[model samples]
Target: MAARTHGPATTSTWAPPSGKPPLASRIMRATWRGLPAKRYDVGWEPGLRVPAADGGPLMTDHYFPRAEGDFPTLLVRSPYGRGLPWSPMYGVLFAEQGFHVVLQSCRGTGGSGGGFDLWRNEAADGRATVSWLREQPWFDGSLGTVGPSYLGYVQWALAADPPPELKAMVVQVGLHDPHALFHAHGALNLETALAVGTGMTYQHRGMAAFVKATLRLQRRLGEATTAQPLRGAHVAALGGEVPWLDEVMTHPDAEDVYWNGASLGEVAERHRVPTSLITGWHDALADQTFEQYDRLRRAGCETSVLVGPWTHTSALQQGWPEVFAESLAWLRAHLYGDPSGLRPTRVRVHVGGADVGGADEWRDMEDWPPAAVVGPWFATARKDLTRQAPADRAPLASFRYDPGDPTPSLGGPLLSRTAGSRDNRTLEARDDVLTFTGPPLTEPLDVLGPVSARLSVSTDTGHADVFTRLCDVDPQGRSVNVCDGLGRLRTDGQEASDVTVPMSQTAHRFAVGHRVRWQISGGAHPRFARNPGNGESPVDATAFAPVRITLHAGSALMLAAPADGAGPDTAANG
Candidate 1:
C-alpha cells in the first residue's frame, strides 16, 4: 500500500514578485515585500495573565514590535500550547511585520486556569479575552484571529457576535459543529475520537510524555479500535482521562443542546465579520469548513475560500507559509484598510494530477460546483459505469456484510494515521466490495464540489451502512480513491428504494487516458462503525450477523464535475 495524496494540492495561479508591492501577486505567493522585511525588533512577554469572568487569570504570551508605538493586535486562542512555532511563527513572524501577536491558552490547557469544557465556554471566554486586550495600552483595538483546528473554532466562537473592534478573521480548518466530527454518519469514528481526546487532554504532560503517548497509541490503536464495549477503550489504550470522550459515547446525536448550542452554524446568522477560510479536500473537517463558508457567505459576511491538495495537518505540517502570507495579506486588507490585500478571487481551488512548474495550478471560481457537466453514471449489469442507464430491472447485485469482518478504511479524510490517497488496488480486490469502472476518458475531466450516489437497495438488517468510493483509474489499473462517503440506512421494516450517500468534495483534474472508478462497500471500519445487522450498540454489543445487501439495476453514481472547462453535456450517463 503506497501512500498517495487524496487531499488538496498547491497552485501556480499567482505569486508575488520579489520586493514587489501587494495586490499584484501569485495566488499562493512564495515571496513578497508587501510587509517590510523587518519593521521592528521582536520581543516576547510570557505568562501575562488576564482576568476571566469566572476562570483563573487566563495565561497569555505576547509578541510585539520593539518600536514604541501601538500596533494592530492579532489574537490566537487555543487549547494547544502557546509556544515555539505557535508563538514564534504567528507571534514573532507577524510581530516583525509591525503587528502585535497575542497567543492565549484556552481555559484549562497550557498555563490557563479552570476546568476544560471543550468549546462550551469559548464564546464568552473569547469575548472576555478580547476585552482585556482593549485595556492594554499597546493594543490599538484593531484585532484579527488566526490558527487552525481549535484555534479556528475560537475565531468563529468570537465572530458569532463580533466585537466592534474586531476587524478581520482567518479561519483555518475550523469545525463549526462538534457533531459533524464526532458522528459523521450517526456512528462514532471510534479510533479518531480516541486519538483526539487523548491528545488534547494529555498534551500538557510535557514533550517527552507527549512523544511516548503518541508511540504507544501507534502500537495499540489496532487492538483498541476493535475492543468490545468501546466505552472505556481509550482509558485502556491511552491511559489518560478525557472527559469529552464519554460525552460522545453517551450522546451520538448532534441535536443535543450540549453539541448544538456550541455550533458555529447555530450562531452563524449572527456572524458579521469579513472572513477567509482555508482547508484541504482531504482535511478531516473539510465539509465543515466549506459548509461554514457557505453559511457565512449567505449571511452576507464578506468571505472567500482557498482549498489546496493537502490534509488536515498539511497546512501547518512543516510551516504555514501557504496560509501565512494568505492570512497576512487578508488581515492587512480588512483590518489595516490596505486595499491591496483584497484578493479578487472569491474561490481558489487547485487542479491536481499534473503539477505544472512555476504555475499555481489553481482555478479561480466565482462559486462552487460549477454549473455545467453534472452526471449520474448509472450502474450496469456488466460491472461497468455507463452514461446510459440499464433497461433491465431484474438483474440485482448482492453482497454479504459481516460486522465482525468489516472492510478496512483506506485513506480519504482520516486522522492520526498516515493519510491522503493510497493506491486502492489491493482493497478493491476484496470480493465484498463491488467495483464499477468507466471507459478511459478522451478528454480532461475537472471535478469540483461534492459527490453523491443513489443506490437502489434493500437489506435484511434494520440498519445498513452504505460506503461508496470514487477513484481515478490510470491506464496501469491502479485505482486511487479521490472522494468518498458513507450513509447509514435505517428502517422500521421497509427498506427505502434509493439511499443517497454523499461522498466528500474534491477538486482534481482527471486527465485524458485515465478512467473513473467507483467502489461500493458495506463499511469502512474505525472511520465508521460496522453495522451489527442486529439492534445493538457497538459499545456493549457482542453478537453479530451478516447483512445481505441487494443493489438493483437502477443504481447509479452521481457526480458533479466540469467538462472541458464548464462546457455543456458533461453529466455522466454511464
Candidate 2:
C-alpha cells in the first residue's frame, strides 16, 4: 500500500509486515515504545450492489483494513450519506482498531437505488449486506454495528432477526418508539421532525446550493436554532413539498401509521445480539434509547446503557473523542480476539452538579431508579395550579398565554440551528408565565432522574393546552430551564382530579441559596404544534381565539420528587 503524511511526522498508510516493520509501525514504535502501537489505513472505492432478499439492490461502500488476512467487519447502515463526517470517522476509527468497516447507504439514500421507505425495508437490506460482507475475501465471519440516530435504528432493525455473522452492536441516540420521538405525548415535534426531514432530503438531493444555504444558516444561527426560512426554499427547490413532513405535523398521536414504521419493542424482544446503548439526557430521542435499553434487559439480552450530559450534536463535537474510544474498545473486544474489554450490565450516567469541572461523572447501578431509590413527591394543588413539595399549602398562581407572542424555544434538544446557551431570563419576565418559587433549601438537594407535575385544571373551552416548565432560579432571579412537559386536554379530559405529566430527567444540585421554580403556561409555540383553542386542527387553525384556563391551588398543581436519596450527589443550577 502507498504511504503519505500530511503532518510533521512521516507515517505509512497501511500496517507494516510482522518481521519487516513498515514506516507506520516505526512511527508508532518511536512515539510509544513501551505501549501498544495502533495503526490504520483508509481509501475510497466504487459501490457494490448487494442483492436484497426481496429482489432489490442495496449499494454499499466497502472500507476494509489493508492489513491483509481475515478481519472482523463493523457495518454501519445509514440513510444519511455514507460519507457523512460522523460515520466516516467511525469507520476509520474501527479500522484503526484492527477491524474492517463497511459503510452502506440505506435504500433510497445516497447512491443506493429505489425510493425511500423509512424502516420498511431495512431488515431485508441489512441482512443482505451482512451476507455479502461474509462472502467477501477479507471477511473473518464476525460482524458488529455502530452509529447514532437513524444509523442506530438500522442496527436495531438488523438485530431483530440478526444475520449469522452479526455478533454485537453499538446503538446511540436511536429511537425505540417512533411515535414517542416524533409525536411526544400527543404533541407533534414540528421543529425537530421538520428540521431533520428537510436536512436529510437536502442531502439526498446532493444540491450544492442547498448545502451552502444550510451551512450558512447553521453558522449564523448556531445548530440549536430550529426555525428557518428554508422550508419554503426547500419545497420550491424540490418542486414539491415533502409529504412526510405534513404527515408528521398532522398526525400528532401514537397511531398505527407510526407504530408500523417503528416496532422497536418487538425488535428488542427478538434480538439475540449483545448491544451497547448510548443516549443524551437532552436529546429528542432519549426516550427511545431508554425504552430500548429497558426492553432488551427484560428480554434476557445482554445490554449496557450510557446516558451523557449533552445534546445530540454534543455526542459529535464535545463527547465524540471519549465515546468513540469506549465504543471502539467494545467492538474490538467482541469482534477481534481482544478479551480485555467487557460491556457493563447496569447503566452509567453523568452525575451533573458534582463540581467536577462541569464534566459528567459516571455512576453505575444494577438497574434504572436504583434499588435503593424510591419515587415519592407530593402533588399539592389549589384550584387549577400545581406544586411539588414534601409539605406546602401554597395557593395556585395564574399566567396568561398569548398565542400572538408565544414562548420561543431556548434549546434543550431539538433539531434547530440556535445555540443551546440562550439566556431564558427575559422569557420568565412575561406575564404569560406563572412562576412559583420555593423557599431556600436548608441543605443541598440533589435532583436526579425523571421529573413530573400533577395538575388539576379547568378550561373555559372544551379543549386547552398546558405547558409546565421546571427551572432553577439562582440568587439573581435568573431562571434556567432544567426540564419541561406539555399536555393537551379535550373538554371531557379536563376533570378535577390531578393529572400527571412527565418532564425530562436531569441531574442538578439545588444549593441553599438556589430555589426550585415551576413555570406554568399554556403552550410553547413553534417547538410544539400551536393549540388552536377552538378544538380545531393545530396546523391549519388560523383563528386565534383565547381560552381561559384555571389552575386551583390545593386542588390543582402538585410536585412529585424522586424518593429521598434518589437525586444525584450534588446539584448545580444551569
Best prediction by TM-score: 1
**Count of clashing residue pairs in every prediction:** 26, 38
Q: Write the per-residue lDDT of candidate 1 for residues 1-574, one digit (tens) a residue.
A: 1212212212122221222111211212324333336666666676889876685778887876665544678888878676534655577678777677788888888878897787788888888998898777676667888778878888888887788888888888777777778786777776668767766776654456666888888787777777766777667668766768777765777777767676777555667778888988778888888887778777887788877777787766522666777778788777667757555667777665634223447677776656746688887778899988778655457788888888888888866656677899988888789888889999877676778888887777767788899999988888888888888777444354667888878877677889888899888887776667786776666678788777778788887766565632222111
CA error at residue 288 for candidate 1, angstroms = 0.6
Candidate 2, residue 234: lDDT:
30
Q: Give all TM-scores, in the order shown.
A: 0.89, 0.82
User: In order, what lDDT does every prediction score?
Assistant: 0.74, 0.62
Tens-digit lDDT track of model 2 for 41-110: 6433436687776766777666545454556678887777654463346555556556667877778777
- Stretches of candidate 2 off by over 4 Å are 1-37, 53-56, 204-210, 213-240, 257-261, 337-339, 342-345, 356-360, 372-395, 419-422, 492-497, 554-574
